[model samples]
Target chain A: MSQKEDLSLFVREALLAGRPRPEIAEVLVVAGWSQGEVDEALSAWAETPFAVPVPRPRTVVSARDFFVYALTFVALGIAAFHVVWLGFLVVEMLWPDSDGANYWQAREARNSIAAILVAAPLYAWLTVRERRRLAADPGLYRSAIRKWTTYVTLLIAALVFVIDLIVALASFLNGELTGVFVAKVVIVAVVSGVLFAFYLRDTDRG
Target chain B: MNRVLFALMGLIGVVAVGTGLFVFGGPGTARAEREDQDRLMAVNDLARAISCAYDTAVLPEAIGVTSFSDACRPTNLRVSASQLMAGGLLTYRRLSDHRFQICVIVHDLGRSLNSAPYSDMTAGPEGAACLTRDMQG
Candidate 1:
């Protein structure tokens, strides 16, 4: 409420978010306060701690926390699906069709499967590590973890899908591909687009 | 008891969502699939048509070199002619007497997903599709 309180809040936020001290001056400037005013305000707040009693430890997770839970499960889902899909790809490649239509098709499918087989699990691990890191923080303990992991995973997944979609669409748009390739592109777009949409929507709303 | 009830409710919600996905195929699935079938079949027909369009009446089926053309690689044109609507725009290339290239390609969304399963397409001439889509890296 007071200038001192505002300065303390600013310091707390900046420190918590790991911003450099030099940037605090910029932050103060942006907030339309002079450096002297901000420093004085912060000093006062630091000198006088809040007099309220300690609050109860959190038991029930906030919606953001629950979002982490949901997203973790969703990651598992994606990992599982891709794992199976990768297996199918391996099978197709090992026993590729003898009499040939698309020679490179089988090979491509095989490599694609292998790519997901490696990336999905690695991404999932990074996410879990971040989740654990957040479990200790008082305020952003759980949230920071979930958000970081979700953001990273979402970005990687989106990039992967978008690139793949472009590749798939190339054939049909160019008219060099057959109707079936077009159909495959359509299926991929529909399926992955739905997942991408859900990820984005939840990220925004949460 | 409350926790148990919450768990039960959550379970019900999960089941409902799962059922909806299964029964309805979610949002644009059916529509996408309807359009996709033409694209998917194009792969099949492209291979078949290419084999047929050979200057020689030789169907590659007699030999062992024909599978569905569902991979997206070196793709340039994807026109949907009335003829392709019924059959397909399959073509063949004879590099030499014994060593020739018999292939077909159909463009579709699934084929577009060149990350894991489709990325393999970029390994060959079909990789042209990959080049077009992912020129950055």
Candidate 2:
């Protein structure tokens, strides 16, 4: 059993033995468990007075869910890379002196364009598929993995947003706020903002 | 679900068309760019070879050239197609005693022509060329 399972079992046994909840919590805390863990463990058995509660079955992810989620993750990664690459291309096109286009840049721009072409469509398809599935069965929206993935995407978007802000601020402070820098900052902001807004709205709707 | 599938199908169609265009249209531009890069490298190499001959106190004829002044011409030098010296695509001429010009037909103009000793030239479609001073002096 995992440490959490062991802790839950210990908490259940202590509660059944009529030990005071405070004492159980204190002992667990002294045994290196955090107060938060002790409180959570205690709360799991809080209302069970006489009858032993049946353990809830663990949620099993279906193949379809796995496939969609995996595909979405891969698409999101590709989208992020391509978005940054496209930003660089735009910057180079605008400011050729500071950010000149060379053979490698041309090659990268072509590859990134191809990647975005593929990944953006795939991402849209998976997102629409998941949204439709959730609409048909609202309960599916509560799936742990789905929620986790959405939250993780939100986290990444937030991080990118903050990083873009810092980059823009640094560029401004350095007096390097050329058209290229401004364009790059705008691209990053727009992309991350759209991702943040979409996920935030989805999470809220859920 | 049907709507979702239809949208996905539509997206797939768009991607297919985009990929087809890229596959077909990308290579021609790529090949031209590669050729331009090769031409730039060849010009620099020729300049270096001339400088080497002058430094070693050897005649340009020793390196399969008639003379240093006229050696800039494509027919006078031996270089491979990979160096953009094939089919007389590149031309060279000694403008004066201390200056020489290398000319090439480049399709793309957005790239920097910052190759040393010839960085001042602007890329153009008509014919992008750079003049450099003979470094041998």
Candidate 3:
């Protein structure tokens, strides 16, 4: 049995020996027993395993579905970015390169929109992945803080990618839709791509 | 107990339907073909809208945007998927009839290509909010 299960069994036996719950809790803690172990053990004994049917396996989102959904968001985003960039270029060519109020307002709106869509989807992915992981192995995911932190970190990378996007967009908005502009976007894409691929595989195992 | 089972059964049903479409459906079945047509029509419409910005054998406003499969919206709306697409997309747009902007919309941000700063941009991988209006809606 695992540490938690073993401790739970011990605690259950001790409590049945006429020890009060609080006393058992204290004794378990004093004996360097983790709170999780104590809680698990107590709860398991409190409810008869036979009385409560086992939790059947749940089929969460499949890997293929996840991948397809992910691909669409990425493609649309890239397509939209290029569209706006070209829009700015045409506008800039027609009108002089002037840092006017209308331009700034439009720019801000674009950035804000990008952040909303990008961040929202990343967050959604994080939540779905989290649920999947939690269901897959409760013990590993027992550390609530760790689970949350990892999710937050994934969002952070997404945030960075969005920030880079804004910078690239700003460049285009300012009429920099040139070779150098495309090159920078390429670089950012590569870096974030590697980071995203690596983080997902590593976080689940840990 | 019944409730739990019902919930599980419901989940299984939805998943079953989704899988069936992906597996048993013929290569470009009616549904897939229709979707493709929709996406293509949208893309062609977009391209036709701003063809004045591009110089070539000015192909008539083809309806390529009408060809996107139903799978496009949900899939393209995810961050990880967008990240992948950033590397493979290429398109052109005209700033005006006089000037053209050919941007390689990568998966980084969701702003314009000109020189204006989109400080309020919520740029990210899961969206094509700004660039999607091009040769495809």
What C-alpha lDDT do the candidate models reach, one value each? 0.43, 0.65, 0.43
Position A26, candidate 1: lDDT:
78
* TM per candidate, chain B: 0.34, 0.51, 0.23
* DockQ-sorted candidate list, best first: 2, 1, 3
On the 0 to 100 scale, the lDDT of residue A47 in model 2 is 60
Candidate that beats the other on TM-score, 2 or 3, i.e. the better one: 2
Which residue pairs show collisions in model 2?
none
Tens-place lDDT per residue, model 1, B23-107, is: 3243355444334344333434344444444435333423322332435221332434223433523223444432233223334
Please, what are the lDDT tens digits per residue for candidate 3 over residues A12-118? 56755766677888888899978886766566554334433233232344555445445534533443343334333333333333332233334333443444345
Give the residue spans of candidate 1 off by over 4 A.
A1-142, A204-206, B1-137
Which candidate gets the maximum DockQ versus the true structure? Answer: 2
Give the TM-score of chain A, superposed on the true chain A, for all candidates in the order listed.
0.39, 0.70, 0.32
Candidate 2: segments with Cα more than 4 A from true spot: A1-71, A95-100, A173-175, B1-25, B54-86, B97-99, B109-125, B131-133
Which candidate should be chosen as best, given lDDT against the real structure? 2
